[model samples]
Target: MTITIIGTGFVGVVSSAVFASFGNVVYGLDVDEVKVRSLSEGKVPFFEPELEELVGKSLSKGNLRFTTSYEEAVSQSEIVIIAVGTPSAADGTADLKYVKAATESLAPYLQEKTIVAIKSTVPPGTNRQVEEIISKHTDKEVSVVSLPEFLREGVAVSDTLHADRVVIGATQEWAIEKLLDLHEPLDGERVVMRPESAQMSKYAANAYLAMRITFINQIADLCEKTGADILEVIDGIGFDKRIGRHYWYPGLGYGGSCFPKDVKELAAVSKKLGDENNILVLMDHINEARIPVKLNDFGEKIGGWEGKQVSVLGLSFKPNTTDMREAPSLKVIPYLQEKNAIIKAYDPKAMDEAKKVWPSLFYANDVNEALDQAEVVIVLVEWDEFANLDLGRMKDGGWLIDTRQMYDKKSVESQQLQYLGIGTV
Candidate 1:
């Protein structure tokens, strides 16, 4: 089936490439001409595991194309998917301005029997909101469906291609049937439900994950106080078949695009409905207040930050992606900076994006360069490159703080570096 996806950012472009790669004529539409042209020329705007290769293959097969015009995309495809960003507004409600704009632009182009699907993470009832907008604008009886995305940035291709489950949310029987058939190429379990329930499920998943991260982070602090290791603690509880072990590792906090926004929006939505479940608000509280356990350990030994040279490793929220939105490093770096500490930071891919936030912030070419002239080093993210570093060349004090616990402290000490890992011995 032919599909047109609007707003080719992280979600739009990846979904387009993956769909086109497998077997589909996908038109990627965006307002940014530069972005469309760049994608048209096989230039991916951001990094993902195998997205560029997939896009290239799809483009070569003539299964994928990009454009800036809504008419061009909507006219050529049988289904139009709103894959635009629903970034958080000031009050934590999802700003649907982009989704609204995309829907408005698509109104005139929507023909009779055209299926309009929303593939973005939005608040509940958004499908109806969009459907009403289309109803007011066009006479065509468009079938709107909510197929909220469950994509993780680093491994989006695999997530889309091998999704555990695909939720088909629509009142129209025909729309649900077609969406199931559309996703039949991928072998995800088909879960058909109402649009509102599917939308809430997306938020629920993110909220639960956020709670788990915040829950373990609190435990990590208690571990230090009780002379216990958080790693061993996780090991003891993780093997329980019922509990399982995913998103179980404690860290600085949950960040990037999804969890922060979704959890906040869910809390906001729930508050408006009634505060029966205040867990969402608490999850946000704990995550935002969650401090790096290793940072505190380092602070004990390395005292004040006045005129101290601090090296910050990993700027992105997590590894393999350049997204720094709501990254913990944003909080940590500023805390150090405010203490009059001279900071130098480095990341494999996030340097350019990080520079946008702190343009004058000192950056190094590599880990070695980042460690150059540093007295204390803080690992905010767990990239593989940092884990495989030659620690022997580190600062003379041997002060290394590992927030992700990505390195072995026993081996780190052999390199004449003092290792301070979160909840590790």
Candidate 2:
């Protein structure tokens, strides 16, 4: 099968590379000529661990190629996947202008009855909108389908290769067959459903995960006040067959490209459906509430940082990916700056991206440079390199706060440094 993917963002790039590796001729399309050209040179644009190797292998085999011309890709492929960006709007709805524009651009060139699949995170009824747009411009009978992606940022490549399940939403049986044939090489069950339900499923899954993290963070606050440890409470609760363990670990908060936007988009979708969304509203507020929760905890630990040198390790939303969109570090860093804290931070790959947003922040050359002359160290993001940092180098009277609980308290205490962590004694 000749598969062509539009919008070479994180999802588009990762999915195209995987599809090519599965023995299909894949063409990745993007508006950015520079990015497409970089991929053609076998260089990945983002910092995803091991993606360079996979992209290199696929390129070497002539299975994968990148191009800025959407018309050329659409003319040569049987399966066209729309993996564009659906950024959040001011009204909390997914701004689908980009998705619509991409569909419109390719509508005239969609030769023969090609299967057009949407992998972008869009609001419900978007596939119908896409179908309407395509039918208005072309006489070709296009099979429009909605197949939302559910890959995490850090583990996107692995998740795509070995997905838990594949959801295919189509109106026609042949449309379903086209999608099934595309993913038939994989060994996972295909879930067939209506397009609206498929769209709702993606938002529902992300909102529920956001709610879980918010619930645990709220309880962690209560545990801190009531002299109870949250880890023991969570461990005890996790053993129950009813409540499985995942997304239960308490931390700064949940922040990434999906959870925040999807929750708000779902609430907007519900409002359009004429029903109030209490749970989703609470999830958004609860996730936003952590900005103060984190800053207040830092203030309490460092005794009101006015002119204090604080070192923050990790800037990305999570480990293994250089994505800082809606990351907790952005919220916390600015708050510390308001209190007149001299900030020094380091992340293996996010520094270049972080500098674009936080130009005034002291960019450390490495973990040691970030910690130099620091009165306190805060592990903001759980990057693996930070899990074994040298705590003995911390200045006298300084402390370490493990917000992600990615540290060894015993080892730090043995080195005579005060170690504080969430849900730790």
Candidate 3:
């Protein structure tokens, strides 16, 4: 099937590539002319390992294409996937301006019997609202489907290839059937649920993961006070088949492109609906507070960082990607800077993007460069290169704080460095 993916953001670009690679002729549309042009030239705008190669290969094979013309792209495909951005608004509700705009633009072009799938993470009932809006503009019967993509950063291509389950919600039976047929390449159980249920599934999945991370982070705090290893405790409980071991890491809390924003939006939406006492609200509060764990640790080691040079290793949240939308490292970096600490940071991929937000801070080229001439080294994101760095040779008497537990003490001792990992001495 020919798939037209609207909005070449992270989800759209990755989804389009995956869809096209597997025999589907995919055309991805974006309003940004530069992005579209770059994508056409097989230039990936953001950093995703092997994404450039995948996009280049798909483009060369004539399976995947990109364009700025929404109408042209939508008219050429049998399935239209709305993968646009639904960023959180200031008021805590999802700002659907982009989704709405995309729907309006594609309505006129959606004349044929097409399956319109909302792949973007949106608020509940957004798929229905989009269908109603599009129906009003076009006399044609459009099959709007809520087919949310649950792709995570760093490994989105793999996630798409091996999805645990695919959720299909549509206005008509044919829409769900068409989506299931299209997703035949995906290895997972296909669930034919209602549109609203499908929409909420994405949010619920992310929110629940946030709750798990927060729960573990709170437990990590308890472990710290009791002088117990959170990792060992996690391992003991993780063996239980009922509790499965994933996203149960007790560390510097969850932060990245999706979880933080999605959790906050859900909490805000619940509060607006007078469900202020919701447990999700507590989860959000806990997740938000988790951002300060490293800062508190930093203060404990070296009371005030006034006039101190602090080195922050790893800027990208959770590594393997350059996306730093809501990375906790961003919060901690600036927080230390405000306290009169000169910041020197290094990341495998996020330096360029991080420079935009923190241009004044010193950007180091490598892990050792970041550690050179620093009083404290804060491990924000656990990049593989950082995990095996020669810490002993890198720093002398510097406070080595590992927020992610990315290293073992013996490894740090081998490098002649003092190690301080979360929930570890």
lDDT of each: 0.85, 0.86, 0.83
How much does candidate 1 score in TM-score?
A: 0.96
Worst 10 residues of 3 by lDDT: 389-398
- Judge candidate 2 against the unseen true structure and give its global Cα lDDT, from 0 to 1: 0.86
Ranking by lDDT: 2, 1, 3
User: Can you tell me which runs of candidate 3 are displaced by over 4 Å?
Assistant: 410-416
For residues 1-425, write the lDDT of model 2, one tens digit per residue: 89899999999999899899989999999989999999999898889876888899999999899998877899888889999999889988999999999998888788787999999988778888998999998988889888999888888888887788899988898889889888887666689999888888898889888888888888888887787888888888888879876568688888888888998888776777777757887678778887787678768766887888889898999899899998878887888888888888899889989999988778889998787767889888888789788776678768888888776778777776778777655
Q: Which residue runs of candidate 2 sit more than 4 Å off their true CA positions?
A: 272-277, 408-411
Q: What is the TM-score of each candidate against the true structure?
A: 0.96, 0.96, 0.96
Candidate 2: residue 337 lDDT (0-100): 88
Strongest candidate by lDDT? 2
Q: Which rank order by TM-score, best down to worst?
A: 2, 3, 1
Cα lDDT of model 3 overall? 0.83
Worst 10 residues of 1 by lDDT: 289-298
Q: Model 1 over residues 116-174: C-alpha lDDT tens digits?
A: 98989887788878988898888877898889888888888989989999987888887
- If candidate 2 were superposed on the true structure by all CA atoms, what would the RMSD be? 1.5
